[model samples]
Target: MAQFYTAKQRVTTKQRITVTIEDLDPFGQGVARHQGKTIFVSGALPGEQAEITLTEDKRQFARAKVTRLLSSSPARVTPRCPHFNTCGGCQQQHVDVVLQQQSKAQALSRMLSKEAQRVVAVDEVIAGEPWGYRRRARLGLQWQNKSQQLRMGFRQEASNDLVDIQQCPILTPELEALITPLRQCLRELKAVKRLGHVELVQADNGPLMVLRHLDALHVDDREKLERFSHKHQLMMFLDDGSENLTALSNNQPFYQSHKLKLTFSPQDFIQVNDAVNQQMVARAIDWLDLQPDDRVLDLFCGMGNFTLPIGKVVQNAVGVEGVAALVRQAAYNADLNSLKNVSFFQHNLEEDVSRQPWAAQGFNKVLLDPARAGAAGVMTHVVKLAPQRVVYVSCNPTTLARDSQTLLLAGYQLERVAMLDMFPHTRHLESMVLFKKT
Candidate 1:
């Protein structure tokens, strides 16, 4: 009972004070202050003065919602997309690109310092073409049969309700053109009740859509889909409970990349922005500085995006993934590219990987690209591998910070880190770090 006892604190509203944003928080909120306490403000940017209404006042930090921008920074720019505020797809579009990258780097450094008691240096920002870079998107569909109204888009910020989007400029022209027709296709279906959502995927030749249905499609509905697929030259997938290939429609996926050809299933997780993804892959491989005798290990390798390329430079490389389907695809990509030294396997990476055959082998370099949770479970195995260098790609700054601490404990020093503006006009920042075994 004594151990649970703590100091008594009373709650009271402090005098409202306006402050300029100094940085970005982990959740993409802006960091501001009043009277020595930090305030997390939504929709505010660094170096911008804003009037905010206090939502919650705590012992350390306060929560605020921006009421008005008193003075906008010169770095702020007008967002292109009309759904900027309504659609929850992106954040940080209001901030300039350079400042955005700087804020993200600071966030990474701060989180790492707290976790590891060391500062990580972030390299130059890797940016791409700001617009029309998204190759694929899974749009939400909600059709009101009685009202004859259809809403097809992502949900609004902090709400479950959908946003009606008539046009999307960020996607390829072919994909953007299908949004209207796809909606019409669902409306004309004989069994519209069975329809749930449509997955629009951009490919080499055209767009492929997989319709997820609650019930099986009727004969007329099937015919309508066939006709649409034929007329638009679209590859259509109908899934009642399972994926099915009803008609043989060939629509190749079109990828606009100079060096890398990335192929992925719409259902699979591929970086939505093609341009930035290519830049990221190129930068990672370039920083690795591979040699002929080098052997590399790619952890959380998704469809061999980085594995196959690393295999190109080194004597041999191995990719480990959790999903069998992706492992199979990665192997196929290696074979298709005629890359002799590359191999892939499927294993649950969250568990111990020491039992694997390659655990005993030594690699000159290693690359880790994990999900938002980051790669905490494999740090011990990574250290055991004892590569000369390690490159980590991360989505979440908090998890990245924690993992950096683990790497630091294993005798690696943060050499360089770079923020990639993969999801621009949004708060999400992609970062990469290189560590040298010290």
Candidate 2:
């Protein structure tokens, strides 16, 4: 067990130390060691020297904030966003793009090494166009009574406090331009006080604003929204008791191009970066290499993003999701897309899949897109199924490493791994790996 620092001990002690930033943690924080204990410092880059103030010291590790950069790495760059420190949206904006990819790949490799007892090499990071990539976002609206101003943006790191942002360089230009107008709508609406949150979805067409209101909307507020939507030509949705939306009588959703045409709902979880996501999905399918007679299993499939496309080339595809609603939606997406070979089923994959009937079947290939908590329990089942090849798309490297160990233990060999720059200007990395049974 690790020792816990008492409140009295924490308040009395202040330690000042200079340490060389050794590496970056999975969360994009710089890591350093002093007296054989680890400390995490924000805004510090590897190969840089910095002064750190210990905020919380535990038996095994400590947390800290960088007070001064004694030396800076050449890879460091000025952050594009003014709210880089306060807003928790993008952490690695200050780091060079090439360095960010290296950090992420190293983080994944380290985690996998610890669990697998073997060196794992991560492929070069996939690059995407940096700006105007974010297509989906949920903007927080907070009316600061003292300032008497409405703030529209994300929350500060480690606090419920909202960071008032005038513009976000990380978001698409279309979405960033809406920040001021969104606040204007709030200012005009008397019932904006009842608004819980606002969702901004950028379909290929244009931006769609879904206002989630907790209380009833007054007639004047509704009229204000209608007028704003009409003048700006925006598609607006008001959430009453249900998520059912009534598009503003005057405006329609914008369409960008036929190639990128995609629809989104307020409640659905869409990838924030549109351009990179399209590439990421395409890469997954390409790596899977679906054949006409191939059977594919998409674990943790959400809304058939990958399943429907893979189904187009395979004999049949089954998408299993934890949420029943998502499974239904995925099935609906298959039907809507005229994909005949795709089907969806709800299954609690975190738990044992051996109990499920579908678990008994073997497939020629499998595609997994698990959450930050990677597919731990399902890896064993995957080994037993022993598909010729397995393609895994991961959001978190630590969990991916642990699961990689499970696969290795089950006699699967890691063939190749590559990082996808889905969320640029951030420490967040989306990666894919291919595995084959030994």
**What's the TM-score of every candidate structure?**
0.89, 0.90
lDDT of 1 by residue, 1-438 (tens): 457768889887644567899877645678986888999998887778888989888999889988888888787788777888889887766767677767777777777667766665665788887777777787877777677776778889888778878777777788888888878887787766556677787776577888787876788888888899888888887766665444335443534343445565555666777778788888888878889999899999988888987887889999999988888877877776788899998998999888888766688799999999999999878888788899999998778888887788888888888888777667686789888988
Cα distance off (Å), candidate 1, residue 348: 0.3
Best candidate (score: TM-score): 2
Q: Give the C-alpha miss distance for residue 36 in model 2, angstroms.
A: 3.1
- Model 1 — TM-score against the truth? 0.89
User: For model 2, what is the alpha-carbon lDDT of residue 397?
Assistant: 77
**Model 1 clashing-pair count:** 9
lDDT of 2: 0.79
Q: Give the range of the ten consecutive residues with the poorest summed lDDT in model 2.
A: 254-263
